[model samples]
Target: MDGQPTADVVDQVKDIPIYRTSVERGHFPILEKPEIADGFPDNWMTPRLAAALAAGEAEFVLSTGTNHARMQIIRPPYFLLNSYYKLWSEHPDISATWEAGCQRVSLTTVLATEHVARVNAKKRGGEPEAVPPLDDRRLDARTLYLNLRLDPALWERDDVVRMLAEIRTAQQAHPRGWYHLDCSGYHLAHLVQKARAWGLWEDFPQPASIIHAYEYTPLNVRRHLREHFTCPVVDLFGSTELGYLYYSDRHGHYRPYLDEMSVELVPVAPGSRIHSLIVSSVRNPYMPLIRYRSGDCARTLDGSPDPEKISRFCGREKELLATPHGPVAQADLDDRIADASPRVFLHQLHVTAGEAVLHHTTFDGEPLDPRACAVLERELRGLTGLRSRIEHREHIPVGKSGKYAWLVQDR
Candidate 1:
């Protein structure tokens, strides 16, 4: 989401009085959007599109390049009302995230470290700090850093100081207000490192919750916040078509924001713990779906999921690591990594040569303590049903579709 302006998004909501009556009468579509009555695809943007169209905007589109490839949802007004039902159903607090001077912020680069790109380019105590150029926003609010000349070998000094300055500026602009930090995990991890190097750790602003929604948060980075910060460091799961379906608490555990969603689980294969996440979300009435397969995988941690204790939100179903023994889910491995560090930010588990390589991103700005890494390896080896290699990656690659891939296979 990038620079989404506030229009009368509420007018997009379908009639609620009749739907609420239905819900009270033990019929769910009671409060559902109108498009729901007509039916639409699971991932369609019918309701949201409806709102955008009413405002007369054609740029309404869904996110591409994440796990499910990319899907474009065209929303008209009928579809717009559906979004209200879905967003406010279970998670009423979400309105706050949007209410706090919120707008969508996105980038073309899979791994963007706008926060610390210049600092990583410097030599200790050498030059006057410099900052990279501010993004040029098209009057339409779209931005592109794709051609920003960021040569790794030639990071100058002036921009390093400038980057730090920018981060401070944004955080202070709303010291007590809420803001979404929607950057890559790598970008966040690098920024943390730069903060330590510049002795600016003390100056870092404290937001209500640090949201690592756009990319995966490594276990080590998660621990740092739990060990240090007073506020919550949370993450969420959803696609562009649907705004958000789930969010985690302060301790990195997922809870469903069902809205008007009826979720189902189907096995990826026989006798496999991994199940496909089928969602019938009614957020965009203009695009109501029935039994829609979202192409993501999740397993109930208990016999019946508690909803509140959804320990993990594994990435794309197609990316599950299948082997002779069974399939290894990403969330399971991440839990093990978090067990190793109190503060982690991003992670990549590579299956190579019959062993799992755990590459982590950290807010601590360094590889996990060697002893902790060794201990983590032992736990991961047992979890993955294979040997383990726990290490760090300077930058883990986000999927071609712009989602993080927890598991990768290389012969």
Candidate 2:
């Protein structure tokens, strides 16, 4: 089946309003953004779902959509928050690392000024975080989220000082002085680097557990944290559309947490090890996605396109680079850089017709050698069939949400 859902699966979501056409057609094609977003509530609404929303049984969540258009989706109230807590509180290996009732703090991408204020309001009984608070069946605790949004240049700004102070306060205010750091890995790395620069490393709290769910954590960031901190650094792999489906273990190996979803991987090109992730999820009761091209890519352990052997959720599919030879993914470029030097902390590939420029920085804050640069350029040219140039930088810029893009095209 190669991960594609059989026609019988259509019966699963047979009643969903949006799937009526596909159900009639008898062949469910891959769902795309336009169909998912346009006409939204009406396109997806069913009488039962409408009653759920109107009666406060369901709610809406917004997606950050770092690389594409933002989206709004209907979901069970507190769906993501509850799902996250369930994953943590249920895992024996991960749960023991923290106190039974330790508070959870989210300093990741979802934390922003307005969102923090709203959450605080809910805690104060001034507003409600979720309807009926899920009858208090959901986890109840004050979540200390960041009020400031992350940006590429946040570390260099004066406002970040207050953010650092806020984080310190959150840590110290805890009775045990150890709480979970629910953060984006990139954002956490930025915080640590900035803390070191400001001489605040001594005051920085050591988290009992770390959860990085917002985005992909590069190998360099993971290695740095594992080397310095003696805590479990967990990486949750999933999307806003689908709650986390996989998580990394202590050894950095991903294990499936698939609840109501099936996944398949199709090769990026003929004989290529890399494959695009296609997901069929009926996890969300309000909306279901079938044969959805997640725009995420991965590779198998033994160079075969097998779902069970999937190794890493490597990179995005839309960002693939077209060269004279063939298409190359962000992971391919990242692998080349990693093979070239251990000191390379971050990199971005900017490409134009027949040429490419690499903006990269080293961990030691030193410039990459011209000889080493030439060697990598030669390698990239050989692999991509384009002239490549390396530009050593003190830091490569990140997106507004503090996520780095490995590839940026000029043309």
Clashes of each: 47, 0
Error of 1 at 380 (Å): 4.2
> What lDDT score belongs to each candidate, Candidate 1 first?
0.52, 0.73
lDDT of 1 by residue, 206-242 (tens): 4443455554555665555445456555666776555
Over 4 Å off, model 2: 2-9, 110-114, 118-142, 147-149, 156-165, 168-176
Estimate the Cα RMSD of every predicted model relative to the unseen true structure: 10.5, 4.5
What TM-score goes with each of the models? 0.64, 0.87
> Can you write out model 2's per-residue Cα lDDT over 90-122, one digit (the tens) per residue?
655578644445556666653343454565566
In candidate 2, the residue pairs with backbone N, CA or C atoms under 3 Å apart (3 or more residues apart, or in different chains) clash, namely none
Model 1, runs deviating above 4 Å: 1-62, 76-160, 171-186, 305-309, 341-346, 359-377, 387-404
Q: Tell me, by TM-score, which candidate is best.
A: 2
Collision count of model 1? 47
